[model samples]
Target: MGSVLGDLLPLAVGVAISPIPIIGAILMLLGKHARTTSIGFAIGWLGGIVIATTIFVLVGGAFGDSDSTVGAWIKLVLGVLLLAEGIREWRARGGEHSTPKWMAAIDEMKPLTALGLGFALAAINPKNLMMCIAAGVTIGAAALSAGSNIVLVIVFALLAATTVVIPVVAYQIAAQRLRDPLDRLKVWLEANNKTVMATLILVIGIVLIGKGISGLA
Candidate 1:
C-alpha cells in the first residue's frame, strides 16, 4: 500500500499545486460566505477527484485485466494530449490576458453554487482531467489487491485536496495574519499560472509517454 501510494505521489502533487483551484479558493475566502463557501468548495474538489478516479478504476476492471494493453494505449493517447496542451500553454503564456469572467462573479455565489463550481473545475477542467485520468490508469494497471487499490485512490484524493484544504482551514483559524501571505500566493500564481502549468504538464507528459512505451513493450 505504501509503495503504491509512493508511486502515485507525483500525481497527487500535481493535482495539489493546481493554480486555478488555489486562486478560486482564495477568491472565495475573500468573499461574504468565506468559510462556508470555501469549505463546500474544498469538499466538492476532493469529491470530484475521488468520484472520477473511482469510476475509472471500476470501468477499467470491467473492461479488461489490470495490466491490459488497452490501458497502455489509453495512457499513450493521454500523454500525447498532455504534450499538446503543454505546448499550447507555453505559447500562450506570453500574452496579456484579462481575468476570467467567472472569477468576477465568484464573490456573489452561494455556498452550494460554489460547491458545484469546485466540482466542475476539478472534474472537468482539461488539465486536471488529464492528471486524474493518468493516475487512474496507473492505479488500474498496477498489481494490487482490490482493497489496496481503493485505499491508494483515497490517498490520492486526500493528497490532491491538500492545497485547497490548507487555505480554507487557515482562514478559519487565523484569517487576519494569513490573508497577506495567501494573497501574495494568489497574486504570484495568477501571474505565472501558464508557465507553471506548462512546465508541469510537459514533464508529466514525457514521463507518461515513457511509461506507456515500457508498458506496451
Candidate 2:
C-alpha cells in the first residue's frame, strides 16, 4: 500500500495543480453566483477524479498481475505520450494565452452547468485524464485488497481535487477577503500555465518511464 501510494502521489499532484481547472474554480468563486456554482464545481471535480481513476484501476486489474509485462508496457506508452505533450507545451509556452470561451461564460453559468464543466475538465481533458489513468493503472496493478483500493482512490481523489476545493471553501468562509487574491492567482496561473504544465508533465513522464523500466527489468 505504501509503495502504491508512492507511485500515485505525483500523479495526484499532477491533477491537483492543473491550472485551467484551478482558474475555472477561481472564476466561479469570483462570479455572481459564487456559492452554488463553486460548490457544484467542487463536487463535480471530485466525482470526476474518483470515477475516472476507479475505472482505470478496474481496467488495470483486468490485465492479470501487478507486475505483468503488459502493465509495464502501458506505463511506458503513457510516459512517452506525456513526454511528448510536455515538449509541445514547452515549445508553445510563449504563444498567446487567451481566455477559453467557456471561461468567458462562467459568470452566467448555472450550478448544473458548472458541475458538468468541472467534470469535463477533470475526466475529459487529455492531460488530466492521462494522469488519472496512470494513477489508476498503478493502483490496479498493485493487486491491493479491495479496502486498500478504496482508500487509495479516496486519497487520490482528495489530493486531485484539493486545488479546486480550497478556493471554493475559502471563498465561502471569507468571500470578500479572497476576492483580490483569487483574481491575482487567476492571472498568474493564466500567464504561467504552459511553463508550469510543461515542467510538471516532463518530470512525471520521466518518473513513469523509470518505473516502467524498473518493473520490466
Candidate 3:
C-alpha cells in the first residue's frame, strides 16, 4: 500500500508539473475568467478520472479479471467520448458569439454558475476521462482487489486535486494582487477574449486527439 501510494504521488506530481507554466499564464492573464476556467478544467479532470477509474477498479477487479478484454471496449468508449468533447470544445474556440460554451454565460449566470461551469468542462472532456481509465487499470491490475483498494483510489484523487489546484490558487492570488494595474487589463481580456479561448481550445483539442489515438494503439 505504501508503495502504491508512493507511485501515485509521482504521477500526480507529473500532471501538475505539465500545465503549471501555460495554464498558470492563462490564469494570470485572463484573471477571473481564468479562475472559473481552471476550476472547470480541474472539475472535469477529477470527475471523469475518479468516477471512471472507480467504476473499473471496483467492478472490474471484483467481478472479473482486471486484464480482461473488456478494457478495450472501455478504452474505445472513452476515446469516442473524448473525440466528441474535443470537437465540442473546438467549436467553442472563438468568442462567445461563435459558441455558447466559450465561458461562463455572463448574462445567464446565477450563484451556482461557477460550479456548474466547472462540472460541465470536466465532464465533457474525453482525454481526462481516458486518462483516469488508464490510471484505474494500472492500479487495479497491480494492486489489491478493487474492494480493498477503493480508499487508495480516493486518496490518489485527493493528491491529484492538490497537484492541479495548487497552481490555480497561486494564479488566482497573483491575479488578485494585480487588480490595480490589471483592472484595465480586464478590458483587454474582454476585447481579446476570442484569442484566449481559441488557444485553450486548440491546445486541449490537440491533447485529446493525441491521447485518443494512443488509446487506439
Candidate 4:
C-alpha cells in the first residue's frame, strides 16, 4: 500500500498543479457569480478526476494478472506520450500567449457552464487525463484489496482537487480579501502556464519512465 501510494503521489501532484484548471478556478472566484460558479466548478472538477481515475483503475484491475509486464509497458507508453507533450509545450512557450476565448467569457458564465467547463478540463484535457490514467493504473496494478483501492482513489482525488478547491473555499470565507489576490494569481498563471506545464510534465514523464523500467527489470 505504501509503495503504491508512493507511486501515485507524483501523478496526483501532476493533476493538482495543472495551471489551466487553477486559472479557471481563480477566474470563476473573481467573477460576478463568484460563490456559486466557483463551487460548481470545484464539484465538477473533483467529480471528473474521481470518475476518470476510477474508470482507469477498473480497466487496470481487469487486466491485472500474475505479471507486472503489462502494467510496466502501459506506464512506459504513457510516459513517452507525456514526454512528447512536454516538448510540445516547451517549444510553443515562446508563441503568442493570449487569453483563451472561452476564458474571456468566464465572467459571464452560469454555474452549470462553469461546472461543465471544469469537468472538461479535468477529465478531457489530454495532460490531466494522462496523469489520472497513470495514477489509476498504479493503484489497480498493485492488486490491493477492494477497500484499499477505494481509499487510495479517494485520497488521490482529494489531493488532486486540493488546489482547485482551496481558492474556492477560501473565497467563500473571505470574499473581499481574496478577490485581488485571486485576480493576480489568475494573471500570473495565464502568463506562465506553458513554461510551468512543460517543466512539470517533463519531470513526471521521466519519473514514470524510470518506474516502468524498474518494474520491468
Q: Count of backbone clashes for each model?
A: 0, 0, 2, 0
What does the lDDT read for residue 93 in candidate 3?
Answer: 45
Report lDDT per candidate.
Answer: 0.83, 0.91, 0.49, 0.90
Estimate the Cα RMSD of every predicted model relative to the unseen true structure.
1.5, 1.1, 7.4, 1.0
C-alpha RMSD in Å of predicted model 1 compared with the true structure: 1.5
Query: Model 2, which residues run further than 4 Å from truth?
Result: none
Full ranking by TM-score: 2, 4, 1, 3
What TM-score does prediction 2 earn? 0.97
Candidate that scores best on TM-score: 2
lDDT of 4 by residue, 15-92 (tens): 999999998888888778899999989999999999999998887887676767888988998999999999999999
Model 3 residue pairs with clashes: 44-122, 82-126
The TM-score of predicted model 4 comes to 0.97
Query: What does candidate 4 score in Cα RMSD to the true structure?
Result: 1.0
Cα lDDT of model 1 by residue, 57-98, tens digit: 765565446347877787788789988999998999989978
Top candidate by lDDT = 2
Tens digits of per-residue lDDT, candidate 3, 1-217, equal 6765664554344333333222333433354456665565555555644676676565446533534445444544544554465466456646364324433343333324544443443334343444455446545644475455777777766665664555556666786665554446445555554455334434434443444355447
lDDT at 183, model 4: 82
lDDT of 3: 0.49
* Number of the candidate with higher TM-score, 3 or 4: 4
Model 1 per-residue lDDT at 43: 84
